[model samples]
Target: MTAVRVAVIGCGSIAKHRHLIEYDLQPGVEITAVCDIVEERAKAAAEKYGATAYTDYETLLKEEEVDAVSVCLPNYLHAPVSIAALEAGCHVLCEKPMATSREEAQQMIDAANKNEKKLMIAHNQRFVPSHQKARELIEQGEIGKIYSFRTAFGHGGPEGWSVDGKDSWFFQKEKAFIGAMGDLGVHKADLMRYLLGEEFTEVAGFVESSAKEGSDVDDNAVCILKSASGVVGTLAASWAYSAKEDNSTVIYGEKATLRLEDDPNFSLVAQYVSGEVVKYELGGIQTNDAGGQTTSKVIHHFITSITENTTPPIDGEDGKKSLEVILNALESAETKRICG
Candidate 1:
């Protein structure tokens, strides 16, 4: 397809800061349309990207003849918008926490399949350099027999980065589903699966909304995950990290333990039982910092997938697997019992 014609739905912070910007910069992609409920935001983005703007997504989906779309809307709207786009014959790149529940996620995959369209989820952690290096090391047997692990993603709060600040839809339970778990926890879920190359079989968790004030949704969440291979680990997601952000992952194995983003200088390190050590200088994980190194090669992959007529790296099935982990964690927290 010529330039992989694309449209971006939602002119929010992520749309403005990363998605659109990256699309504009990507070599084989073109920003064809921009849509948002807020007309002003849509107009602003349209002006910036030289793309037509629409206030309603329905009109945009019906009118615009784009090859693909980036569904950057809120959590609740993900499945619906993506389904519509897929049915409209457009490949979709939807943001993370694929949907509010497993059923919704399944419907999305079915829609994509029925329409013969591609669906990619924006799970950016898998594209991180350090995380990629660690995965390679583990796969190469640098970390012999993995036993357990701990991964966490936390920051001050979405209030600082969200388009609506403290009043963002993220604080609204109906709109966000489960705040930190959806926003941050799901990333770790996907990452752990990618790094360990296994699916989580069971999960137990504690989710809380005690961090930020005036928010009804959870700000803190921690889950214990057991993989199909009996590899257990702790995954944490939080908005109460006021001092600094902590997005770290560590894997313990018999031969050597691989640490990712654990030190000040070395972003990835492996320590062996034979007193051997390997330090890597790959960049650390991107946090909520606006000026930080945030964007990834995800856009390039998306465009390439569309042009080459291949399934994206982070496809709908992959997204659903990660979403299941987070959704199960929420259920485990509510029932105070282990969930599968």
Candidate 2:
């Protein structure tokens, strides 16, 4: 097997927990470089993953041997870094909420197309066994016709999770752009789109900073979506929940309803119209410590697409669709009106 040389562009929590660690586990992939503005963080990741370290991403991109790069930077830098890597002849696996705006996301897609490289987004929830099962059932007509759904992802706060606590770029409007919506809501929106196999046509939302004092970004948000197929649903995300919930999605169909919760266990429960409830315990979707399970799967798909000259399951266009949904949600909140 020819190993693909991979470089990580950020040493943040997601990079450390998902990108680097998962790539380390893959037999046909090698973590060749780690980059971060903080030299110490990059060096630590390099030492941990047995890879080279660079404080600037440009240095890593210049390495001729690197076949791929993971853009794990803050929300704002996702598009710029991914475009640079793709233009440099490297496949890119970008983290979720692909970019702060639709235009930026489209630019990344355009660059990928121009370079003829695989570009994938890390919407890991789509790879979870339970979520896949839900998608399968929906596709197979087990749910009849999807009418509506609800999903959420919430956590205590960014204080402990982020390297810089309240001082983290996540709390800053300029660096992070939107708050919980970008941080967590985007996952639910993507999950809903994946399960229903539809694009959100409109969105209405409300955002607030209820928990933290002096926070510029939102700590909680709720958005309602209307899909192209006329399915109506609600998506909620927050960093203010007392207990952490990773990712949860519920789909209501004409014949039944399906529920998926990431923590506690990966279980799929369906309540039928006949009053017979079915439960499926899916232990196969388990992730190693650091939430790298889906990350690893996404990386594998990206590499396979490049190696085989095929399209990835969640390609650049897919990333743009998810980003559009979230961005529209933000616009809805700001104007107190539905947006597309």
Candidate 3:
């Protein structure tokens, strides 16, 4: 089988830790090129991964042998880069929080359609073993009717994790567009949508910058989401959690309640109405970078989708839906009213 020649558009943390390394592990995928605004970073990644390096994404896209591109840039750059990659005749696996706005997200969907290329969003949380188990129980009706949920993804500020520390683009609204909401909130939003298999109909939220100093964007956010199926839930995201929680979701149902906790591993606990609680101790779903393992699974799904001509697990529309939830949360915070 000819390997899928993949190019990575950004050499940032996510790209380095997840995409590049995961693709390297896939036997049928080859890292063909690496791109970053900083030449040295791109060159270093390319050298490490044994791929060509380029400073300009457009130049990297011009590589005739490239079959797919991973849009691993900052949140604001996702749509433009993915659209360009689709137009350039390569499939796209874009990092989450698809775009800063719904309109931009739609444009990406349109571009994917117009180019006849597959576009997948990297909503990796859905691929976690615990998350998948929860989804199975929910789908099998083992939990009975899911009436509500609570989900969150929190961590210490990006200062330490990012390559540039406090100078990282994550602290800048111009580059990141939003802080904790875009960074961690989007994951919970997407994960709930995936597990419940429902669309969010409306939202109300409160966002604040309580922890990180010298930042204009919100460092913490909490939102109420009402799904189309009449399920209601709360989602909380923060960069202020010193304990570093990655992502966790709890589902309440008529027959039972399910809890997922993130830390040493992804474990599931279910409490039935009979007053019996069952704990499932799931092993190492956490990758080197906390969520990187799931990210790898998401990439594998994208590759499978491309090869099989089937929809990716997290397609463009799936990606857009998650972004809409986050955007609505932001609007709700601003207007002090529910937003849809």
Model 1: weakest 10-residue lDDT segment is 283-292
Identify the leading candidate in terms of TM-score: 1
Candidate 3 structure quality by residue, lDDT tens digits, 177-273: 9999998899889999989998999999999988998898999999999999899999999999877455677899999999886434438888999
User: In model 3, which residue pairs have backbone atoms overlapping below 3 Å?
Assistant: none
The 10-residue segment with the lowest total lDDT in model 2: 285-294
Q: Which is the better candidate, 2 or 3, if ranked by TM-score?
A: 3
Residue-by-residue lDDT tens digits, candidate 2, 227-256: 998999899899888664456778899999
TM-score of each: 0.98, 0.94, 0.95
Residue pairs clashing in model 2 are none
* Per-candidate RMSD, Å: 1.0, 2.2, 1.8
**Candidate 3: RMSD to truth:** 1.8
Q: Score candidate 3 by lDDT.
A: 0.87
lDDT on C-alpha atoms for all candidate structures: 0.91, 0.84, 0.87
Worst 10 residues of 3 by lDDT: 287-296
